[model samples]
Target: METLYDSIRDKTRVFERTGVASFSETENGVQVLTDNGKRVEGSILVGADGISSTIRLPAKYRALVGTSRNQFVENPKLPFLARGHMHNVYYEGISGFCVQGVQGLVFWCLFFKEEAWPDPRPASKFTDADCESVITKYGHLRLGTHYTFSDLWQSRVNASMTVMEEGMIEAPWNRGRVVLLGDSVHKLLPLLRRSVSQLPSREELAEAFARYEAKQRPRANICISMSNLAMRFETQDSWWLRLARRLVPSIPEGAWMPFFVEYITSAPRLDFLARESPVGRAHDLKSR
Candidate 1:
């Protein structure tokens, strides 16, 4: 993990006190303002600016990003709350979202089909009461009477920065002293698992990414495509599927440990990878 800037600074804060108002690039490198108007130079500029990355734009990112695209949106106001009604409607053209808050709060989530919704629009522009009118047409979920609308009515301007989908390049990333990392490299895909470690070193980071796109893209897309081809599955409605999901005990036995292996035993894949690499000599002795 990269060290935070504060640790390297003197006991007194080292930042220019004022925040950067603008960013400019020159032969020296990317420059940001200091409270004192001094310029700071960075050798390898890291753009951790997040999903709305200014680093990525129409120029170098011409083929990469290039356009504003809508991805997902949720309305804050849910007139009728249905707890755990959120279904990842894989069947319909769009993904369906439903949530029921514990208190009086009601929230709604939905995924529009690919190229379904346009971007650069404020997300919160529509209030929940307004959304009720839109969602009521979908199904017989009985959302019309299922909510506590009064307490949730404490509201304000309904609008948001519309999220957009990004186009990935066949060979999109540039490599050198300067390269993008984290969300910059990969479009902000939701995490696979909380246990999965995301930190990739600059080198392993770049190589592993290309390796992921090359090797994993096929399987990953296939899973989503299969789900896309399927239908919106309501657990209560889908008896068997819902039963399996509910009864699925994530007993960590077979998954974390391989079949027919000793309790304190070594992992086959781990042993193999370590053996093929310089690190395997250590594992060989341990397994013996």
Candidate 2:
């Protein structure tokens, strides 16, 4: 942003916009909402104000979304937990992890303990002090198994993990003049870990998005549910916890490449779609 702003700062054509005031449709086009009732008429409106947008939408819709409510706190007892390594602790059917990021920074998850936050915020709001308290309270704090707060890059924080599904706002992603994009269409759970950008052309993006939602919705939901279940099983803090951790390799990936390829494409080579499969006619294609 800084780089782009600097490069375009001198250009009169490049200007910043603020305060959406109002808009109306006309025979020619539509007018944009602006401060002091200013107008910048255009042919279209793109609602990109996030999942729970503040703007009044005509074709309003919703997608099932899951959120993780996190908070940060200081952990003076064990400072090293702020380093970049994973510390997964389990108790009963609940599971969670204390992982570190940059210097003095830790990211955490508690899939078991439930809290309510229908309106989610960016995860960065959580602090280091908040993280330590949560870990010390819920986690079966192993005194010396891994790095603790004392080894913190800066200080310790206790972060909360409150996961919830948005059940009320669920609907098909489109209506009429208003269509949804991003979270408004299909709200992904944390760690699906990818973003879909606006396609180059408007028509191109709309068509592509329609296809994407149809194919990807079921699979994405399954991944999120399975992840939660897996976390629960892994974090059992009973005498069984130790045994489970030992038997499982560190960081087992629950992914199948061949299965995914087959699901999305007709065949590995897509040759059948091309009139002939290379598997049966490799030599014929090579000779040609």
Candidate 3:
């Protein structure tokens, strides 16, 4: 993210500490008035402002996310502390994913089911006490095979909790010269990338936005459903679910290949970027 920012900062005029006060469609483009009494004009407006997006979305889960000083880096002898791989650990009613990254930090998120919130849900800010409650409850869960959530929490460098919105907005994502993306339109529990390219006139932009939403909506829904299912599998206390969880690690790799293939092939690559040649059995399955 820092690399991308550095590359683009020279070309991009970024306004900091100011938010959209209001916006209107101009004859040739969109005009945005900022809270600081500044006006900015652009060919079109794209809202990528995250879960607390100015654009509306419904939320169904709350998550606590944090970064910890990597214990593996501190110890250097910890087993299975593989960088760039996610370790998902679960306890009843909570699902946690932790990753030891190459950057010498351990990032983690604990997501749990919550009552659904309507569009424009009230602002929720979780206190340090709330974070402590989480740590007190589920901190014993193992991250990978060696480290526990308690290990991460105790060594925490930073932490915050926020409500996670789910599902796509029911209203049109684009209006006149404006469009929305990411959590502004569809908010998935897990990480998903959303992108739009090209600049066009109002009519063409509207058509493009419609096409983009139509194609991406189903894919976003599937991702949301899968995330929800995963949360349920990790959190539910039902007997059959507990049995299934016990059996999951023993499930054969072949049983998962088809889903893996579909996920890989469904990824959309930018036309302007270089394409890699497809290889391996997944490519063979796709070709077939």
Expressed as tens digits, the lDDT of each residue in 1-288 for candidate 2 is 355367775565343555557766555445676785656665444443443343212221111111111222253444435345567655454554555565555654454433433333433333444454455554453313654322332232432332233221246443322344444433442111123543234454446555645555665555546544444455452466556666666544555444444444431233333554334543344333
What lDDT score is found at residue 78 in candidate 3? 59
lDDT of 1 by residue, 4-39 (tens): 564574644445334456556555345665656766
Candidate 1's displacement at residue 114, Å, is 8.3
List lDDT for all candidates, in order. 0.36, 0.43, 0.69
Candidates' RMSD to native: 13.6, 11.5, 6.7
Regarding lDDT, does 1 or 3 come out ahead? 3
- Top-scoring candidate (lDDT): 3
Please list the residue runs of candidate 2 whose C-alpha ends up more than 4 Å from where it truly belongs after superposition. Answer: 1-40, 50-87, 92-94, 98-124, 127-140, 143-169, 187-288
Q: Which stretches of candidate 3 lie over 4 Å from their true place?
A: 1-12, 51-90, 95-130, 140-148, 155-165, 187-200, 237-251, 275-285
- Ordered from best to worst TM-score, the candidate numbers read 3, 2, 1
Instruction: Tell me model 1's lDDT, rounded to 2 decimals.
Output: 0.36
Query: What TM-score, to 2 decimals, does candidate 1 have?
Result: 0.36
Give the least accurate 10-residue stretch of model 2, judged by summed lDDT: 60-69
User: How are the candidates ranked when ordered by lDDT, highest leading?
Assistant: 3, 2, 1
